[model samples]
Each structure stands twice: as structure tokens, then as C-alpha cells.
Target: MKNPTNGSLAQTFQTLEEYNPALNAGVEKVALVLQTMALFFLIVLFIIELQNYAKKLNSDDGGLTMEIVTSIGMRYLVAFLMVMASGEILDFIMWLAIQASKWVSSVLPEGTYNMTVPGIKGKVGFFEKPIVFLFSAIAQLAVWTNSYIATIIIFLRAIQLFIFKALAPIFVVFVMSEELKSIGIGFLKQFSAYALQGVVLVLLMGIYPALMQNDFLAGDVATGMDAWLTNIGVFFLIFLKALVVLVLIIGSQNLAKRLIGGG
Candidate 1:
């Protein structure tokens, strides 16, 4: 009997497939490289935007404030685009890994079976109608018929750092004109940033590889892009998470020093 406490992860661990030598390494390498490039570019772009923003805000140029606002909005837009692109790339990689595992399993000396991928997407349910109103109140009233694009644009404009910088910290003062307090400001900032992160990733996780049919990583099996998807399974993703953690730890220390004034 399986323990409920062990959770789906236990199943995942138990089910890790052993694939053909050529397919496994090939898919993994391709996934790893593509994922690494995407993450690397995201970090690099974030840093670039941050520096540019710091300059625009602290500069005396008359147009600096406007430039900063535009830049921030566009950063979100670009970030959203990149995130969407990455998802397609990931799907391609995963699909390849699964197919390779299937092909390899069919020909295994011992004869293997039981291959499955764990992914679940719940569609709109009857009970979810009430939530539509909640989202709609916050969501944009789009003029364009392409609701997705409008939502993305509206969200970018409304939730970006520059807009939040102006909006999140208002405080009522009896002594003088009102001032904005920084209380709860950190939460708001993080929430908006994370919201953007989720949407970006969701978009990328679906459509990326369609853009590059030849992008799969199965080198041994690929004569053309038919082998573009990878075979690494989830190990490459595990490695990427470690990289993000390392980066966050180092970046947090630097960020803390900057905020509170000390290294």
C-alpha cells in the first residue's frame, strides 16, 4: 500500500523511465541547453532593465520619468513574450523525451512498459462562474476583440513597477497633504512581479517549439527537426531550479545590502 503522505512525487520517483542510451542523453542535452539559454536571457534582460530604470529615475533629464514609465511597461510586455516563447520550447523538449522513451522501451532487451506523463489542466467549470466577475472587475475592459492581447497590455500597464511606484503607497496625513507609506508595499510589488512571472511562463510553456520545429534536442535520432525535442525527462528541470536558487541567494544578499545600506 502507498502512503498518502508520500504524495504524487513518490509516484514520480518510482516511475522514472530508463530509455535508450542515445535518446536519453540526446534529449536531456537539448532540453538543458534550450532551457538554460531561456533562463539566462531572462536574468540578463532583468538586470539590463533594472539598470536602465535606475538611470532614468535618478537622472535630471526632463523626459527621464516618461522614459522610465514606457520602459517599465515595455519590460513587462517583453518579459511576457519571452515567457510565452519559453513554454513552447519546453513542451517540445518534453514531447521528444516522451517519444524517445516510448521508442526505446519498445525495443528494450528486457521489454519495458508503463510510461506516463503527469500533467493536468482543468477547464472552466460551472462553479467557477462567480470568479469570472471577480477577475473581470480587475481585468481590463478591452476595446479590441483579441481579448488575450488586450489583457496582456492592460496588465502590463497597470501592474508594472513604475505605475506601482506611483500607486501603492498612499497615506492620509492630517498635518499636511497626504503622503505614501511603504507599508505593505513590498508585498504588492512582489505580488505583481510574481503575477507577471506566472503568466509569462504559462504562455511560453505551450507555444515555443512550434516556432522552431528543428529545435528538439534528440541528436542521435534527428536527421532533421523531427528529433528536436529532448529526452532528458525532468532531471534538466531539477538542475535549472538549483541554478535559480543559487542566483536568488546571491542576488538577495546584494539586493539586501543595497536596500539597507551595507554589504
Candidate 2:
């Protein structure tokens, strides 16, 4: 499969915003089934609420009244409508989050990271400087590996968002009950974390180019063996920086959660 993240930073964000695993026919069918089941459960819960209210009506306290009954009915009606439109609601949330991140990224200097292995100008004399050659090879491999892993992480995050979308209807039902509201709130927090993760990733992308521009490297001029050694060292440093970027990207969801006070 083509790497979805193999694109400009803006394109990557667009891909994430547009991702919908339920576009697959099988997944669509499963989501529909889940939605239908949720609707059924919602109806059952509403009936149970009415029964409990009726019991309260029969009590001497007379705490429950017709207005409260109407309020309960209206609450379920709204929940039912929200469950029916859950997909649209999720899409809107994702779009809003991605757009917010994009706006934030726009304020930063514009640049892109080339995740591909940096090309070496001359062939390495493997017999003479074996350790340099080995380090050079390792750095190139690390760059390629980082690119591959970043693509996989983006793809997996899309899948996670899809799973959250599929379960949204069920969670909407949870929100209808005071006893289960926390469960529903937890689901929303996690969904928000994944949704807002792009913010951190975009910010990192915006900052990476500036981070890589070293004054010492910018002014340096080397010749002969020194030049070759310098290139190896520079590539190794890039690999190290790329490794740190990958770590930050992987932890982005947690960072998002913390930002939203989900922790």
C-alpha cells in the first residue's frame, strides 16, 4: 500500500481529516449494525426512565411532575437525533480540529522536512574508514526507518479515529444516563486526543526545519577526508533529530490529552 503520510505536511493533514475507514463496504455495514443496535438500546433506556418516573409519580412526595416528564422526553429526543447524526458530528469535530491545527501551523515559518535519506556525494572507502562508513549506513537506514514508521503511525491513528466514530453512537447512549455520563465523557476525551494530535505533529513539522539549520554547519567548509567525515556526522545528527521527532509524534496524543485536561 502507498504510504498515506508520504506527502506535504498540509496534504498529510488533509488525508487525516478526510480519512473514514467506514468507506469500506464491510466496515460500513458493521457501523450501520452498531448504530441500529444503539438506537434499540436507547429506546429501551428511555422506556426504563419512564417506568422509574411513573413510580415516582405514584409516591406521596409528588416530586416528579409533567414538566419533568416532558423534559425527560425531550432529552431522549435530542439524544436520539444526535445518535442518528453521529457520523456527521464526528466529521465536523475532526474537521474543526484539523483546521485549527492548520491555522496554528500557518503562523510558523513555512518549510518541509525531507524524510528520505540524505544523499552522500562520494563513495565511502569502506576499508580505510570502516567505522565512518558503518555510521553513515546506519544514519541512512535510520532516516528510511523513521519515514516508514511515521507513515504507519499516521495510518494507525486514522484507524483509531474510525473505531471511535463507529462507537460514537453507543457512547451517545451512555451520555443519556447520569450514571454512565462519565463513560461517555471518557470516550469523548480520548476521541478529542486523537483528533487534536495533528496539532502537535503540525507544530513539530513547522519547527523542524528551523531546528536543523545549525550556524556551525551553515558556515563550515571542509575538504578531503574532513569533508567526508563531516557529511557522516551531519547525517548522524539528522538521524538523531529525526528520531526525537518520531518520539514526539508518537506521544502527540498524550500531549493533546494533557492540553485538554483529560488526564
Candidate 3:
């Protein structure tokens, strides 16, 4: 099969050619448009909210509405940018991963197996093919995307934390004024922090550790114990990570309540 972007730049500038210029440009364009649109709405929303805040702030004993909104908005903006960057980074990882797998297969394998990736078919020797494939897959999906995803998750959790912090004051009043029976929002804010924190921690903490033990890490013999260990290790790693995350959710919410005074 022929290379999807460019064929066999392998002999010259091997790594360079693997990057698809056309796709990169396209991805960049889309990201730019999204950022621009998001910023536009953010600014417009900020202006409107600010105006509303101005009117209410002085009327309500001139409280800290302006400060709270400004701070939360800044956090929201940062979280949004991080999310977009995470997306672009994921695209790069996906493309490079396809190429890396092929390269490894070619290097180690003395012509053991064939890999037809991105619609391009090629023969990979047994010498290093398995490791190559494992490495490529692990690095591309499990590492590159994993890290950014973790960051995204963290920032997302932060965003939720910020929102809850912003709302805690309002909810207290709502509980008092609207009857305890109608305090659904209060309960939601209390519980939401726990749920969000666990998710972020699991994605970030467990991913790389699992990747480190990958079959790609060393040796051939993808048979017997090696293969079983790799598969089982991955499962347990993720499970443990998830457990850590759960601890964080419940724990962090309590911490946040004490430190940041949020639900």
C-alpha cells in the first residue's frame, strides 16, 4: 500500500515527512476558528454578565459579586483554552502514532508480519515488529493523548470546582429561603465535586504507569507470562487509578469546602 501523506520519506527526513502538512494546517485552522468564536462569546457574555453584576452588586449591600465573577470567568477561560489545546494535541498524536508503529515494525522485525496502516501496506520483519507496534500504539494513544486528556480533565474539574465555589453562597440562601425540601441544587453542588475529581485523577494517574509496563517496554516473546502480565497490568492499573480518583473526589470536595468555601 502507498503512504497516506507521503511515501517512504524513510530514507531522508524520516520523522519530518510523517507529519502531514495539509492536515496540520487544517486542524490549526479549525482550532483557530473555534478559539475565536469561543473568545467572542466569552467576551460578549462577560460584558452582559458584568452589567448585570454592576446593578446587583451595589443593591445587595455592595457584596463581592464583581470579584467572584471575574475570578470564575478567568478560570473558565483558561479551562476552555486548555480543552482546545488538548484537542489539537490529540490529533497530532493520532497521526504520528500511525507512522511510528510502521517504523518500529520495519526496524526490528526481520520480515515477520505485515502492517497496512493508513491504507498503506508494508512488511515488518519479526526482529522488532511486535515491540514496534506495541511501542507505537502505546506512545501515540496511551501517552500523547493520555497526558493532554489528563490535563483537560484536571482543568475541567477545576472549572466545576470554580462554578460550585461561585454557587455555594447562593445555594445557602436558596436553602434557607426556598425550604430545605427544595434544596436540590444544594445537594447537587455537594455531590458533584466528588464525582468530577475521581474521573480526572484516574485518567491522568493510571495511564502512564500502565504504559511504562507495556510489552513494547522490552523483549520479544509476546507469549505466556509476558502477554498475560501486560494485559492484566493494564486492567489493574486503570482500576487502581479509578479508585484513587474516587478517593480524590470525596476527599477533594471536603478539602475544597474548607479551603475555597465551595460546595
Which parts of model 3 have CA positions greater than 4 angstroms off?
1-139, 177-263
Error of 3 at 128 (Å): 6.2
Q: Looking at candidate 2, what is the lDDT of residue 145?
A: 66
The residue-by-residue lDDT of candidate 1 on 18-126, one tens digit each, is: 2134543444454445544544545555556666666766685534456765765575555445343433433343344334333433343331111112121123344
lDDT of 2 by residue, 1-263 (tens): 12123453444456333454335344445557788888998888888888788787778566667898789889888888878887677777788787777677657654445334444545445553666666668876765665666567667767887778777888877677656678777878888887787666777656665666661244453656666677677777877887887788778778888987787
TM-score of each: 0.19, 0.78, 0.30
> Model 1, poorest ten-residue lDDT window?
169-178
Candidate 3: C-alpha lDDT: 0.40
lDDT ranking of the models: 2, 3, 1
lDDT of 3 by residue, 1-263 (tens): 22212122121112212334554455445545555554554455456656676677868778556577767577546545543453433334334434444443344323122111111013344554555455444434433343444445444543443333333322322222212315534444443433333332332232324333442334443454355444434434444544454455335446534432344
Which 10-residue window of candidate 3 scores lowest in summed lDDT?
112-121
Q: Which is the winner by TM-score between candidate 1 and candidate 3? A: 3
